[model samples]
Target: MSLLETLEMLSYLVTIVGLPLAILTFVWEQRKERRNEEEEIFQRLSDEYREFLKLVLDNADLHLLRREGAQTELTDEQKERRLAIFGILISLFERAYLLVYEDEMDKQTRRMWQSWEDYMREWVRRADFRDALPGLLEGEDEEFTHYISQLMNEEQKVP
Candidate 1:
């Protein structure tokens, strides 16, 4: 073939192969970046939950970790503190629900969300937490309120 014809054929080959390859690579990288961002968000939320647990541990006198709740009646000041802690926990759960939960999630997203769901289930299992939930959920995200309410109901049904 003439030099110009050879050059034209090379351009055609590139158009047929390189263009689609480039598009595929771009899409793959974008997906990978999105996954990384999601992982980072999940990690940050996990850290916040750890901090909240530390707060719970610090107030062990309140017996917030107990499934049945405090053995003794809480003094007024302790009641106030316990309510405040419950409020903080509700806020964290709302944030997680807003950020992580979705109506239609991919496998990776669902896996990450399962952890938050388990946390909510654990808290809802606590009688004191269930009792405080209505007050703590006031003015929170509507979807989160609905979601946690469902969890509370489901947990209540279990023996």
Candidate 2:
């Protein structure tokens, strides 16, 4: 073959080989970027969940103290504080739900999410958590017990 023709054929081969490699590199980088984003989201959710659990536990502690025949009366101010904290807890749970059950979430994480939701609903129902904290808490010791168990389960995966 002529030298020019040979060179042209070699250039064609190079293009064919380089195209897929370039495409593969682009795909790999895209995947890595997505992975980094997902990791950041997971970490943020985990941290927020930990903080939420802490607040819930604190609320439970206050409830437990009152349940033990220790000053069960909650003033309006105290009730407002409890309501504020509980509302924040609910918001955290909603965020965590979105995080853990995001479109790409794996099966195990989805299962944990189902459990979390069920536990939250159960506690809310048993204690009528939507009602006035003072009156509900005075007679809702069992709900606190259930809450502790759910918190333990939720925190089990944390380091």
Candidate 3:
């Protein structure tokens, strides 16, 4: 073929192949970046949960970690502190539900969300936490209120 014709054919080949390849690569990179962002958010929330657990451990006298609650009646001051801790926990759970939970999640998103669900389930299993939930849920996100309430009901049914 003539030089000009050969050059024209190369351009056509790029238009047919390289253009679509570039578009696919761009889409793939965007998806990867989104997944990375989701992972980062999940990690930050996980760290916050760890910090909250430390708080719980620090107040071991309150027996907040116990499934049945404190063995004896708490002093007025301890009751106040325990209520405050429960408030903090409910706030964290609300944030996690708002940020992570979704009605239509991909497999990876669902997997990340499951850990948070388990945490909620564990806390809800505690009788004290369940008792405090209604007061703590006041003025929180509506969807989160509904979600956790459902979880509380489900946990209550478990033996």
> What are the root-mean-square deviations of the candidates from the true structure over C-alphas?
1.1, 9.1, 1.2
Model 1 segments beyond 4 Å from truth? Answer: none
Model 2: CA > 4 A from native: 1-3, 56-61, 64-73, 99-159
Q: Candidate 1, residue 21: CA error in Å? A: 0.3
Residues 54-136 of candidate 3: C-alpha lDDT, one tens digit per residue: 99999999998887889999999999999999999999999999888999999999999999999999999998889889999
Q: Any idea what lDDT model 1 has?
A: 0.94
**What number of backbone clashes does candidate 3 have, counting pairs of residues 3 or more apart or in separate chains?**
0
Q: Mind giving the per-residue lDDT tens digits that candidate 1 earns over 81-101?
A: 999999999999999998899
Cα-based lDDT for every prediction:
0.94, 0.58, 0.94
Model 3, which residues run further than 4 Å from truth?
A: none
Looking at model 2, the pairs that clash are none
Per-residue lDDT of 135 in model 2? 44
